[model samples]
Target: MTIDRSSMTALKVTLIGFAALASAMGVGRFAFTPLLPLMQAHAGLSLRQGAWLAGANYIGYLVGAMLCSMRVPATRHAVRYGLVAVALLTLGMGVTGRYDVWLVLRFGAGVASAYVLVGVSAWALPALAGHDRSVWSGWLFAGVGVGISLAGLLVLLAGARGYPPAASWLALGLASTAVAAIAWAPMRAAGASAAASAATQHAGRLSTDDWRLVLCYGTFGFGYIIPATFLPAMARDVIPDPAVFGWVWPVFGATAALSTVAVALGSSRMKSRRVWAIGQLVMAAGVLVPVLWPGIAALLVAAVCVGGTFVAMTVAGLQEARRIAGVNAARLMAAMTAAFALGQLAGPIVVALAATNGTRHAAGPSLLAVALLLAGAWALWRSPD
Candidate 1:
């Protein structure tokens, strides 16, 4: 009935990793999604401008992912330093209303987020596996969704109370700072263990399967991002009530948080790639839902479907990376992350260009995303178990 010392340590480590991810990804990377509508209403921000800000963040993500792939920073150092950067950059977003300044801040946050993501995975996954608590990975990754839900709910509450975008930004920044403080010591304890493991992994070229995994991950990134980026805005268009439309993002994030844990619990017999394939198919269906149905109801369905599967796909893909690359998994994880970043970087630009051409909704890009997701799912299905 009593938990052992090692078990306690493993749980502590997992919770720290969870907090790090929630701060880095939920606040640093995605606080903008829920805030975009507030910015549009109170700050006179345009959809085209929002798209540019999103694009800038994704570009920074690509840069950070590439740096991680090269192993430019130690895992613990990267996580600790990156968390600090994320807190600063997120707070900076509220310091000014200038579009140019916001661009720079979002970009910096993106870089910090990628570093934390790769660093945490590199650091925590091994420790969890060592303790035979690998199932805890679902909870670790669930930080992204939980963070997303928290950020969304905060913004939703603030918007209802007549708070401006800056106020919401400040609130999230303060919250991220607190999370960083909590995660600091445990993350520092990761030391050189992750790097030592990486040093022993294969230095050979990637196989066809590895390459396929990277490409499919990239497709998944592109496929889900349109809705991920603009679901709140899209819902706002369909129904203008902030109280009503504001619920979309939190619903999306809640589904995402819960689904990963469910998959972790139930996927013992399934191959990681197979789980990933099914997730993609489900996401593709979600992307197609609004286009086919054209209503607020459909958008909520898309949110559930897309949000639910994206994190599951992320867990599956990363687990597959570890299975295939062993101790060398960090580099492979980074490479896959870079590809995902590239896909993410493209999504906003696609939307920006569409807006420039006077297309308002995500329909056009959503269609393209669905096609690519279907293709990715097909490729993943063909991959060996």
Candidate 2:
């Protein structure tokens, strides 16, 4: 089927873009959050063990992002295959009891998620920009939050009916596969023209502002990742009931979707750099909220703060790169993603090492360090270049 890009309206394009992201990222990547406590309940995972699993996934993400920046042929087909691979990896998690197997599956899922992310951005953003419908890109980024919320809601319902974490994994995998099928053809065909187009970019000659963006991006990764990874665990420890604390992930997702949409609607008046800076600062405050209060209420607030701003910061930072780098956006985006991946990769490792003392209580000081790093990112983002 020859799909005509010109014939597709903004609404269709937006939904297709959203499905691609929702499938690849929302379920493929984050179905882990709600599954974490369930894994603890059923699979006997400790905090440090869980951090290692998450770390493996982050390392895979860094590799995928780096590969996405390279000029690869038939990338749309690669993305389609990647989505199928993600679905399989997600299902594989349910059948495996071995921790090493779990790590490899999660790592594969991470690679798939990055492919979908970069592929969708490569396909959808430019198409929307061509149509003057760039605002719809918010819906694209918001797909991650939506995926997170949907998976959370699914697990919440499953737990209410006494479903195990394995069931949750299977259900989310099926859900991802279903969505992947719908967008498979569209995603495979949507952005083919740009797949081969790499703008001329000089390596080893980044400007001061470019390095600044990379540093801030990395710090934002470190800042958001800890709370993002462990928030539900903290909630489960405190609440001990899936039905109640399960709501936290959904709330985080809701805040993220709403906030991204709101920011996108106002992007014309607000510069992406400013938006990125504001998001970094707001995320810093969110990271601190749970630390200061340490309860369901504060955790919920932390969810909103982190979920709401992380996507916003992502949109702002990546879009800002496009604004500054023009056709060279792909290279710069890849560099920033590598740095960001490094930051998140370190986040879980930090937690794992901190927990080596055989205490789950190591998150406090580590998170405090993450918050301070976010503060420094905010300062760099605001300081004159």
Candidate 3:
């Protein structure tokens, strides 16, 4: 059977969205995770300093999401230029050793990653639905996992070869450049259809259920970020072996990449909130594992549990928002994202403050995250669909 023009266009949009997300989220926002331990080893970067850097990126993410909520940047511009910005900022990290300079670069990268995510979703989702190819949206989000895994594996290989964090950063930067180039042309051809409609949505009035969804999504963000941010570093503390510890992130990313596809296929049978609640519950159990067991094995389990579910949670949360809000979904989604960003921003800060004398594991904060996640899951399950 021959594929029609709309089908080809939808496929192109999927490819563009995937490449953009991988660059923005994987290399731009999360490359830092795998590189963090290397920085600590080669650059004498302390855990507190790392936490600060993570916080800076999360702050920028919040700012970018807010900007998108306000519809400040055109969709195509955000996707096209945001990919370029992430590449440049990622490259800048390799060239700098100063702590302050690193903070600025990470912050800028966080903004660019958010722009690409929002822009691509807005641009591609409708285009796919119009083509009757909305099933590809799951693959679009899989870019995040693919990017994360690729970046982590690259750092793992580079670090094994005795390369410095700078080298890994530079390599990731170059890879991001290539990924950005793949998405460039298709993004240009994609129409700016979603931005205008999203701008006029009156999302100011939120019912109780809306508030619950926002808070639950925020809780998901806070619950997952601690391990997501520092798992490799934590694993290194147990094994001190890059080969073993390095696998954690790749496993995490691989699980995440597969989980979205699984959910997308199976989601027709279950309500989004139910899927979300179950995922969050599993994440809470995962977060609880390291706290209770305290070893590399537990952290790996945490990685699978958390990573497998975070993206699914994101997909479900957005779906729930759209279901509840209809045309107002854009504003609701923004509110949920801003809440999530705030939750992520708080995760690293809480870790920074809770850890004493450069310790990697903070049991108290982990337990707190577990509690929040469990509570969020319960809220999601109890809320009417």
Candidate 4:
């Protein structure tokens, strides 16, 4: 059988698309969550400072998403600038001896990550047809999991070997640059002709449901981030082995990757609102596990449950936004992203209040917040015309 040139080209395009999306989604956004503890320890950051840094990143993400949603030319220019920004910001993260500078760098990284995610999703979605759209989109999103897991592994290796924090960050930055270089060819091809057409067709103002979805997604963001940003440190406090902390993150990322696919499949058959509510409930249960059990097993279970639902909520929330906003999907997505950013900003502050009591009991208030948010989401899901 003779191989067709067009078929080969299409295969190459698909592979490249996945790689680019993975680089943008995975390494760009998620690596920070897993590295929080290392940054805190090496940089001598207080809990409040750590929360502020995390919040700053989310704020930057909000800014980037909003910027991308506004003008076609700005969005296009962002793709080129965003990659370089991420490379530099990530490289700067290595030099965390200065808390203020690290906070600024993390914020820059968040901005760069938001642009990459929004830009790539916009460019990639139209190229996909029917089921391929969902599949590719889920896979692209899973890049966050892959990137997170890799970051954990790298940090674990670096920390164990007693590498300087700056060196580890620098290495991660170099790796990101390499991924960006590999991604450049495919991103350029994907964005070449269709960018203008897609922008014109998809760009618009946000709708009422867009607001509701944003409010709901912001709650989901608060619910998930509390666990993600603090779980490792929590585990380290309870677990006897320092090495155990490293495993928690990989577990979180791995389960998150698997659950994202599951949610994508479930969305096709079930209403997104229902799926989202259920995911939140599941996450609440996960959050409570460590609180109730106060052991490594509980922490492991919590990571899986919370990690799975975090991305699932985003997927379901975005789908709901599309249904509610109709043609204004891009604007709606940006709005939801903004809501998520605000929620993320609030999460650590909320958790910090619980931590002030000087007990692992902090997990209790955090989990309670998650449960209440999910209950509210369920009510929202049930509401009808």
TM-score of 2: 0.92
Name the lDDT value of residue 281 in candidate 2. Answer: 76
Error of 2 at 126 (Å): 1.2
**How well is each residue in 1-385 modelled by candidate 3, as lDDT tens digits?**
1223542477777778888888999988899999999899999999999999999999999998888776535567889899999999999999989999999999999999888877776556656766777667788788899889999999999888889999989998988888778767666655335445455566468889999998998999899999999999888888887878899999999999998888878877998899999999999988889888989899999999998998888877877877787667766777788889999999999999887764445787888899999999999999898
- Whole-model lDDT per candidate: 0.88, 0.77, 0.84, 0.67
**Candidate 1: worst-modelled 10 consecutive residues by lDDT:** 1-10
What count of clashes does model 2 give? 0
TM-score of 1: 0.96
Q: Where does model 3 exceed 4 Å of error?
A: 1-8, 192-204, 358-361
**RMSD for each model, in Å, please?**
2.6, 2.8, 2.7, 4.0
**Candidate 2 local accuracy as lDDT?**
0.77
List the candidate 1 regions with Cα displacement exceeding 4 Å: 1-8, 201-203, 356-359
lDDT of 4: 0.67
Tens-place lDDT per residue, model 2, 65-94, is 777656432446556777888889988987
How many backbone collisions does model 1 have? 0
| Model 4 agreement with the true structure over 182-292: per-residue lDDT tens digits | 666545554544455354555555656556667777777777777788777777667634466778888887887777677766666888788888887888788777777
Which candidate has the highest TM-score of all?
Answer: 1
| Model 3, global lDDT | 0.84
